[model samples]
Target: MTSSITDVAGIEVGHFTDARRPTGCTVVLARGSAVAGVDVRGAAPGTRETDLLAPQNVVERVHAVLLSGGSAWGLDAAGGVMRWLEEQGIGIDVGPARIPIVPAAVLFDLPLGDQRVRPDAAAGYAACQAASRSAPAEGCIGAGAGAVVGKIFGFHRAMKGGIGTASVTAGGVTVGALIACNALGDVVDPDTGRVIAGARTEDGLHLLDSRRALLRGDAPRPMLAGSNTTIGVIATDAVLTKVQASRLATVGHDGLARSINPVHTLSDGDALFALATGASGRTPGMMTLAAMAAEACALAVVRAVRAARGVRIGELHLPAAGEI
Candidate 1:
């Protein structure tokens, strides 16, 4: 409903958080009849109900979509979403009971915050029940609360990253993007082509130069596991099948390329999802709309970085992009 992604209709977003623990989840819901699809391009994406995204899957309606913090462990939050939907009498019917089908995804945030912190079923249910007709909140909330980027070398050289969103309208169809900006690369200003935030040297006077560092024979090789990942969802009002929705998700990654440098790395669990609210049956031009969606997603990622607040990790001040 917001102008950001005004082309997508009848899509609602809700967020649940534990500020003390610095972790949470965001839920996106299609209040009415909608077609949804997903695309996972990363080598290490954590997701649920992926089978439902296949064209062959007979189930057409997804009661809720969940994005949460807690790495793979956070997947349990979907149980809460299921419980909420079940209470609302939604989902597939079997005999006298209805089972809720909530597709969910997660980003690795456990190492960034209180290691003991996690998102649970209660949080998921709260997010689903809180879905609203307003713009989604950006930065340091939901699954993005503990997200970070530009840590190709190590956490000492990382920068804070979070959630961002944008929307566009073309040919009367609307596409909106919501992104968790966690990556293994620097965030650049797409408009000016300047590094706004990224890894820094121990002295903090120079950039880490990740590519150069990697090529250096003298540089110590850092473990490439569990650094960061960017996950996103693109919602539209276009009436498309699950197959088309999957393609749109892939197309949406162009937005990530425009905003983040050295994206989709082995350490990055980048994933994108595309959904259709099925509010508009008119077929809009695909290529043009895809391009616009990418641009909007890029901008949304930048906004997420800018919106983050500083956090003290060890002895260093991990400043958020906009905080500086």
Candidate 2:
């Protein structure tokens, strides 16, 4: 009943928040090595070891999944996760040595805070050291620390984005999601169909409603490609094959679409990872698990924005959902 990703039996969450800047990493550790799958929907993505997650791949499980800030450079964090897992004698026994399988994704948080600073190997190692079965701290922490959304209008009108988690259970099966909301569009409440956090008007006094703006012939601000993304992980305790796990990840994106406006755009590197611990030993229907996974993911996306606090670095300040 933690209402977090840790609600899954074999999942452990950890984070490393850098004091020097608003950038860091989050690690989801399945020390027992859970069956993993991935779906990358965005045109721009920074990831590592995702190809191995394909159903036809040889590796069926991953020791950890890393979500990080610092864009492409953040992929370095996965190396640290590998080192830590190896230290714990975790990973696939390859006869001579055990090589840990760690899949990772990164979002762009460079425009906020200090762009010069980014997560590295040490940061990833520190996150592993902090891993635990407890519900993790959310909002303006870890990879979500420097996250900002509503970039369609530009960062000046964007709101603070952060980490959030939620879980759902049905028929003795449990599904959970950990979302780091950092999209190039606005976040909406699927239940209410209201814009909760996103771009602001010219005066920065109201929501610009990016979708509407685009419909009205307002072009998004020009920016470099691969500058925004929403990355996350979905965990479930249901027994599943590699294909099912991959399907779960794909269905999980439906949650993001329900909650985020104009998602999977060329500018957003949205990626989701699905990890099945199979601790429950129950093989539920695909439809049931899919529904639970999407629900959990949408809930987590909303929570990420709501729990976030306004961030002020230098003269620029990005407000949180509640503030607006």
Candidate 3:
């Protein structure tokens, strides 16, 4: 019970954080490769190799999944992951070479950090070197280091977001989620239906409740397309086909909908990747797996905002959930 995605067998987690700025990348490695699929729910997304995960694609497995900061430029980090996996002799064995399939997604964090210092190939390799079966460090680290949420009002009023993980076991199978939440809307507690972290009021002393503001006709501050996003991975030990894995990823969005108000908006790029290692060798009921996926994803999302630490860079300040 590490309560982490690592709790799922055959899954390893790692991070590479840049001290120069609050931007980095997280890698979910399945060295042995695993059946993988993805669902991109938001209108704007920055990703690589996602099409290969489609059911009709030739590739049926992936060596690693990457969640990163620095927007689209961060996609370069995937190259490093491939390099590391190749060194381990892990990947699809084609006639000519063994190519590691590394799919990746990136979120917008350019404004909070030194945009020029985005995660590069070397950074990805470093993250792979740091990979471990141990529970990963959460909040204000890795890809979520510079994450911010509740931007409907504007960045100045937004709160800090971060990476979080949660796992659930049912019928001898385990499902887990690791989320880097950087949304354009507020985070809400699913149980209480209450806003936990979001845009601040005019005084910057209270939660503005983005959902309520929308209903009350508060004109939201306009944001550039693809300026925010929530990216994550869902892993399970149960046996699943590529189609099932994709469905799991799609249902995983229900978890996001439950905890994040006004999610899947045009300004946010929300994506989830599902990996089934089949370490348990159990073909559990699809309904059971889907329920667990959503539950774990929701828990991880809430934890992300709660575990986050406030950010203060010069005049810019993004408070953690508890800070207010």
Better of 1 and 3 by lDDT: 3
- Candidate 3 minimal-lDDT segment of 10 residues: 219-228
Output the lDDT of residue 18, model 2: 92
Each candidate: what lDDT? Answer: 0.77, 0.93, 0.93
Comparing 1 with 2 on TM-score, the higher-scoring candidate is 2
* Tens digit of per-residue lDDT, candidate 3, span 1-324: 459999999999999999999999999999988999999998999999999999998888999999999899999999999999999999999978999999999999999856898999888999999999999999989999889999999889999999999999999999999999999999999999899999999889999998889899999994798999999999999999999999999999999999999999999999999999999999888899999999999999999998899989999888899888
lDDT of 1 by residue, 1-324 (tens): 334443367788888877766678888876564667777766677889877877788876676688888888888899998888788787778788987777888888766657777888998988887788777788888888888777766677777878878887778778888888878888888887677677777766556656555667435333355446788778888777777777788888888888888788777778787778878776686787688678878987888888777677568567777544
Question: Runs in model 2 with CA error above 4 Å?
Answer: none
Flag clash pairs in model 3. Answer: none
My TM-score estimates for the predictions, one after another, are 0.91, 0.98, 0.99
**Against the true structure, what is every candidate's RMSD?**
2.4, 0.9, 0.8
The TM-score obtained by model 3 is 0.99
Instruction: Tell me the lDDT of model 1 at 80.
Output: 92
Model 2 C-alpha lDDT per residue in residues 1-324, reported as the tens digit of each score: 459999999999999999998999999999998999999999999999999999998999999999999999999999999999999999999999999999999999888766889999999999999999999998899989988888888889999999999999999989999999999989999998789999999889899899899999997893467898999999999999999999999999999999999899999899999999999999988999999999999999999999899988888989999786
Task: List clash counts for every candidate, in order.
Answer: 4, 0, 0
